[model samples]
Target: MAGLLQRVKSKMAIFAHRKARGMLDGEYGSVFKGRSLDFDDLRGYVPGDEVRDIDWKATARHGSPLIRRYAAVRRQTVLLVTDTGRNMAAEARSGEAKKDIAVLALGVLGYLAHRHGDLVGLVCGDSTATRSLPAKGGEAHLERLLGHVDSHTSLDAAASRIQEQLEYTARTIKGRHLLFVVADEIAADDAMAQLLRRLRAQHEILWLTVRDADLAPYPLTGQVPSAEVDYCSVADSALLPWQPAASAAVKAAYTRATAERDAARRAMLRAAGITEGEVAGSGDVITGLFALLERHRRAG
Candidate 1:
């Protein structure tokens, strides 16, 4: 079988050709707060090189503007945090497996960190148990991390409780890290909000929510296109598309409830100083991640 990171790189390469090359890398690099001043080498300055980084002596000696490159004092550690449970195996809003979307999000961010010369780690689990992989560098380590998430999540796994993973991270991980979290539409409660605030104080946090499938029928259109399909929830509940809950009145209620829920989640994360992004399927992973990283950079 082909490697997952190759798939991620292919998507990035395609996006680069479509848009501007290295645009995603530039965005990812801008979010980190510090850079080392220990000089590594000097190179000819580019058009967008920082004016303050120009070395006059080097420029005069080389007969052109030169920029000093620094050896990174320390490699930043990015902790890929996610839930590997039945909920993650459920259908996403785009009718794709939610776990696949989670894999793409994690792989893209891990690859970005790898490209930035940082170590990447993984912390993922369901309600029953949590697992952590030590921070390590190299594409092999990243592939293992992605594989862990991909292989462990399934409909037969334990119920989703992302909070357990977060709590484990807070308890065991002593060092500060950039936490990239991907999960389903988890409700925001006081305890979860408090946990996020605590984590935010200790580390940089970015969230990507994999939207759950919309169970109700299309609103006010009398459309039952999927009425014949049998839908089953991760919790073993059968969801008939033609159920009473699919009525127009019920759809309206669901819409309002969903809006309120989404608003509450955004408010909670904003209060905790975390930037949140949404991806509906594999297709939206790259664009959603770009927006997420850009928002985090702007927030900083």
Candidate 2:
């Protein structure tokens, strides 16, 4: 775990020192454009004005529609919510552990927050237990928060009740905040969707899903000798031999199913007004995060 922290810190150091005119810097400006509670002024309502932002009282008095504008707050609150369940412990195709990828992802965001002098906090747990750290500033506090996450995360933990974590966050956190949720490739169910809707109403949300190795595309080879593979879950564990060959049709079907699932997940997140990024456990987490942030920057 110490080595993992050191590696993450090293990577983040590079990111932190990058030139202000770099792609990441530009994107960060556009993506996080002026999110603040400080009111700037009132203006004539535009066609795309958010209904919630409209000053109805002012409009009635002036007999004209008006909208309130706010300057982006310099110091923002950043919260990292992670699911440390058994599924997150699985190995990726690159042979790197999913938990490690998750930690790297968290580190990237936490370091960014620290650099900006923003308050950083965390909400992480599995089905067995959940933990939270209140938002605080300073590099030392951020290090302690990351260390706690590293110590508590376990692959042998029970299935994650992600909804419970969300509930806890919604209940405890007040005011507007930037929320980053890191978890496995689990689709949003109805209950989860409802919870996300509520949270999105109050906070800016970014979802990062760690891709599962089993879902990666593989070339089909002719039938070969069977090999033993270990399969374990919260309920049981076993090592069983299985055929290596998969027919082209089976491969195509699997690919289609994976695509459809991904599409559905994307749609669900969009509906909740949340941007999402998928990071393969075996891939460079920093690169993936940069891509995600770039996409959001472009969209914004």
Candidate 3:
């Protein structure tokens, strides 16, 4: 696990340098503050001003719309809410385990936070149990947290109850935090969307999905060999036998259903005002994460 963490860290080091460049140039918000802004000054409202930034009192006093500007705070908090469900152990098209990709993704963020002298914490769990580490600064502390994530998150665990983790974070974590939710290709059901909305009210939310092979569009032909797949619940598990021969119609229907689910998930995230990115299990996770952060940085 230590070796794996080192490899991830090494791969992410380059991206981290890029992040530093953004900070120095003030092009990308610095890691310490990133998107976190503190009230700085006020100005006349521009045509494109965000409504939320409008100062109603100032507008009334000045007889015109005015907007408040803010400066990025010097320090911030980052919390990683990771899913350790059994499905996360599934292999991706890249033939790498989703859990490893998840770890790498978390590592990149953790390293960045550590470098910026910010607090980094973790909320990791599966269906059975969830563990949390309070936000703290230091490389040693980050290392321990990563080790814990690697040890506790497993593919053999029961189905993931991600809502439990989300609720836990909402209840326990206070103050504004940059929340990174790492999970599988689970559709954002209504309950999950509600939870995310609640979290977004106080925290900046970033969702990173580890893509699953099951959701990948594949060429479906006649007489495809398949195996039994088990779908587990808290109360019980059900194993469905795979069809020995699937018709083109069946394949098309499955693909359509998966696509719809994916689209719905994107919509849910958008509704909750969350930015999201996806990394293939076998792809370069560091690069994917850098891209995600780059987007966030530019937006911020």
Best by TM-score: 1
RMSD of each: 7.7, 4.4, 4.7
**Whole-model lDDT, candidate 2?**
0.73
Query: What would the TM-scores of all predictions be?
Result: 0.84, 0.80, 0.78
Per-residue error at 257 for model 3, in Å?
1.0
Tell me the deviation in Å of residue 4 in model 1: 1.2
Give the number of the best model, judged by lDDT: 1
lDDT of each: 0.86, 0.73, 0.72
What is the lDDT, from 0 to 100, of the residue 282 in candidate 2?
32
* Candidate 1 overall lDDT versus native: 0.86
lDDT of 3 by residue, 1-300 (tens): 355457666765555676742342232134334445445788998788667678889989999898888667767788989987777766754657777788888877777777676788999897777789998998778888778877776656777777889999999887788888888777768898898899988888778988766522234333433444433322234543345114467667877887898899989988888888888763556656656666665554
Model 3 / residue 238 / CA error / Å: 6.3
Question: Which residue pairs does candidate 3 place in steric collision?
Answer: none
Q: After superposition, how far is residue 277 of candidate 2 from its true place, in Å?
A: 0.9
Q: At residue 291, give the lDDT of candidate 2.
A: 76
Clashes of each: 0, 0, 0
